[model samples]
Target chain A: MNTKELIKANNDKRKLLTKETQKYYEDMLIYIRLSYDKSEHETEEILTEMLDHLLEAQEDGKTAVDVFGENPKQYADDIIGELPKIVTKKRIKYMGMGILYFLAALAILSALFNVVEHYLLDLNELTYKIYLGTQIANLMIAIPIAFLQLIVILHYLRWETFKNINKVLAFFIYWIFGLTSIGLFFVIIYFMPSFGPLIEWNVWFNLIIGVVLYVLARSVKSFI
Target chain B: MSLRTQLLKGILEGCILAVIEKQVVYGYELSLKLQHFGLEVSEGSIYPVLLRLQKENLIKGKMKKSPSGPNRKYYYLTDEGQEALEDFRHNWEWVKQPVDQLLDRRDNL
Candidate 1:
């Protein structure tokens, strides 16, 4: 056969094998995908290469098991096993970074809480001296929320859609979320009078600092 | 794994590098050449090795237009790969004598 005809025949055979071995291929692909953090293009390349080999085996009158060995899953596992060690190493690096980001986020949140408390809470000298207990209580409430926000930001960092987004648009999205978080903080503090006591603000000075810190701490790019 | 399969796995990297060292080829063509030389390897099995080689900077792949289909990733050895092949040749010579002697003794037994 000429090259073109051979190509067509190979493609036809591939289509037939794909129909017959759909579940088999899916099982292997799913295993690989879950086991690695490979990009979609890399994943597709692997699948295509494997399918081509399977088609060639079929053309040679050998079954999939004959070419891929008795257990195709084992073959797939062996292939993954032989992959560069850097894959797991890179994952560990990301995990380390995630932990560091989490700790840094907690530190910033604690500092913000201290600043807000110092400026806003109405306390006499005795209560102010004992404010450590209140600070710890505030931290108990704030840490979990801060951790949840860190997770959300980390998730967005790995998001494929965001990677494909325009840089300017992504920057705008981060600003929007940052501004919204600051606004939400303001609303919560403004309504504090009905639930408890109103906070004393030094006009716009404390508000400006609070908003700046909140935005910096909560920005998606900070965690990324 | 069977002893033969284990042996194939060990030598496959050198064999692939040797092939690409001789000529620039894509995955499918490389697999065909390896099979033609009586190595009983699956066509797809070469890719993981290729990926590792590329990762280590021992080989590089370039996308080139093909006559009958989409662009294909053609591989060629880097300078590092040439050095690796030379090392393999020296090691193979050192290994061949002992391995042959062992097989010869086993046959006599």
Candidate 2:
């Protein structure tokens, strides 16, 4: 079966597992499934087989812990050791989509602010020129930083080693990081030399670009 | 790990290859086959070995519609797997005799 099919079958089959067993199994499941650079298709194939095997073992009175041994992470690592990595084509596709999506979000937010100020507050800056530095800050510094952060976050989530931290504390950590990145964005833009060719921020045009890019990102997700 | 499990780690792939050589098997069924033949490890342990064998091109898996429940991934021996099994047999014969002779507690008794 294909990767998506295997994943669907896996989700459906996992309902057969007991709650505690499922908890343990799914922790390993999500961890393995999101692991960086792993082959998507092969990983799903094996994970599906793993769920099936675990269910079969459960029939024989074995829990996930029993079937996978005490260290489920170690077992998962062993299995992951042999799975192939994603091809370069898919990797490039994701990276491209990420860049476009990031740009689209910035444009959309700027459009919203412009629209609100002009139409609602009667401010006449709807067609004001956008600074070139903002574009560079976003594309050069912010986009790359966001993608790097995404990679790290995905890695951390899959590791799940943060279970020792309190849930509230983890949320706070994420919140603080979000604030820090935003702070960094402003700091960079402030220091950016504001001299460049005039680039107008036409609200209607940006909104259209944002919608087009939003559509593009959605379509890009359907590629793989 | 016990010395027994440590030793099994090296040879388990061969044992699994031997099992698949006999007939097509899925992960769970292969684990049961190993248990039936007296290997007392976790049933999940076979998956790593299966993955490794597949990586080495010794075996390949196919998704099949099982008679009951989920679509099981069934594995069968490849041409390389058959050759590897034969080599394992030869190597087992060669290695087993001397190890058996050395480890035979009956002689000490």
Candidate 3:
């Protein structure tokens, strides 16, 4: 009740923290180590906080370890729960890159069909010239789109990016949509001389489809 | 003091320091010596602490490839660690004196 009693009580209680509590602190350090990679300062800060918690729990008689141990796998299960859905850093970036590649392939294939349609169908000279240009331009556009796709894939697979899924999604959405729209705009501009007013509608339609497809792909990647 | 348990640990540290001062020794052999001295520590606990201590510069470590399983890390005490062991020995002597006196006095009473 008095100061000496309190001091003795505190000292005695300190002895009660138990080996299990120390094990809990050790387990926490292991958790931090597994979740993070190669930052000594971060590791040290985490350890210090864990030690403080262990000391406090020793005094309080209620360690977090106690709560966790009541269910043997509960601690591991909680960490497993904390994990960002099964989506890996590689997979998310792959989704973004994969979608962009598919779009590029689609555009190329479409332009090819147009070329064949014009020549084989005996279309007018002006239309044939424009279709030929469309095929050439679509092939040209594919190069940069492919490179951007590779960059996104590399960035996504990097150790830092792999830890978080949302960042990968954000980067892919930004680049894939941006690049594909630009590619389509160029395609339209290249054909503007022949298609004239029809070119504007083509641009908007392609842009809308690209955006819709990107969103659907990202949503699916997050789940699957 | 619960540090009573830590006394054997102190001796283990000294033995490790002495051995490593001579040549690098792998974990399994080091653990075997400690167990031979009747310090029943687990293999897992020993290596992790050795790694941590090595990181702290109390010791130095390097890995050698093994034909089986993974490579093994061999740890040796640093000059700084030997100096630390001397300080630990001096402090431990003083700390033990009073505890010894207290135990002796209880029997006399």
Candidate 4:
């Protein structure tokens, strides 16, 4: 199966597992899936294979721990160690997709706020604001913070997963980190004082740029 | 690690390649074949070894629809795998004699 099909089969087969087995297998699933350097195809392939094996074993009254062994983390790591790494060309495509997505997201968010604030004011109060400062601050602070948050949350999930912790608990833990990450973003950031003289960033201008960039970002995603 | 632990991994790699040479098999079926021959190791350990074999290009896996309808990955040996099994047989021939003689004398004692 291709990587996407493998993922679907893995998810479908996982439902056959007992609740306890599903808990353990999904942890291995997250740990293996979230690992940065592994080949995506092989990773998903192995994950599907593992789920199939676990399901069959469960039919005979075995748990995931029984099928994979007691030291689940080591078993997973050993399997991961054998799979190929993502090659450089594909890695570059992955990064390109990520960069476009974030750039589009920040622009769209800024445009949204600008439109909402403009509508809230009376025409007398509707003054043009140069968002050059906000845009620059977003690139400087927001991107890095968002990237850092992604890494931290993925790492946290992987770490928690390697233990006996289940998915429901891991998800709630991620929610707390997510809220804290956004809160951290707003509190520490200061605008760059609207320094760029060339860009007007009027309400419609922001809206247009946001839409165009979002389209560009999504096309990049489809290209990848 | 104990002698069995140290040697089983290396020996299992050869046996796995040999089995794949004989017939196309999935992970569980291959595990059953090994056990039928008295290897008696945990079934889970087969996957890591199969992964290593695939990485080395001694075996290649393809997803095939099983009789039961799920797509299962089946493994078959490459040309390189046939050569590897031959080399393993050659190595085993000499290793077996000395080890057997030593064990045979030890049993006499």
Best by TM-score: 2
Better of 2 and 3 by TM-score: 2
Cα displacement (angstroms), candidate 2, residue A207, comes to 1.8
Regions more than 4 Å wrong, model 4: A121-141, A164-180, A183-188, A191-199, B1-6, B104-109
lDDT of 4 at B9: 81
Q: Candidates ranked by DockQ, best first? A: 2, 4, 1, 3
User: What is the lDDT of every predicted structure here?
Assistant: 0.63, 0.83, 0.52, 0.79
Instruction: Output candidate 3 Cα RMSD.
Output: 18.3
* Quality of model 1 by C-alpha lDDT: 0.63
In CAPRI terms, where does candidate 3 land?
A: incorrect
Per-residue alpha-carbon lDDT of candidate 4 for residues A1-224, written as tens digits (9 for 90 to 100)? 66777778777778878888888888778888888888999888888878888877777787777778888788888888888999888788777777667777766786677667667753322236455656676577766777777788778767877666777986888788778877786675542455564454356565667677778767876765
Q: What are the per-residue Cα lDDT tens digits for candidate 2 across B46-108?
A: 888888888889999998888785578899999999998899889899999888988998876
Write the residue-wise lDDT of candidate 4 on B1-109 in tens digits: 6998778788999999888888898887787799899988777899888888888999999999888787889998899998999998999997998798887855663
Strongest candidate by DockQ: 2
Candidate order by decreasing TM-score: 2, 4, 1, 3
Score residue B1 of candidate 2 by CA lDDT.
73
Residue A96 accuracy (lDDT) in model 3:
64
Best-fitting candidate, scored by lDDT? 2
Fnat per model, in the order given? 0.23, 0.87, 0.00, 0.60
Give every collision pair in model 4. Answer: none
Q: List ranges where model 3 is wrong by over 4 Å.
A: A1-33, A39-224, B1-19, B65-71, B105-109
How well is each residue in A42-152 modelled by candidate 3, as lDDT tens digits?
234323323433454356566554333443233433433333332365455655656655774565455555556557996533231234455445555665666675565
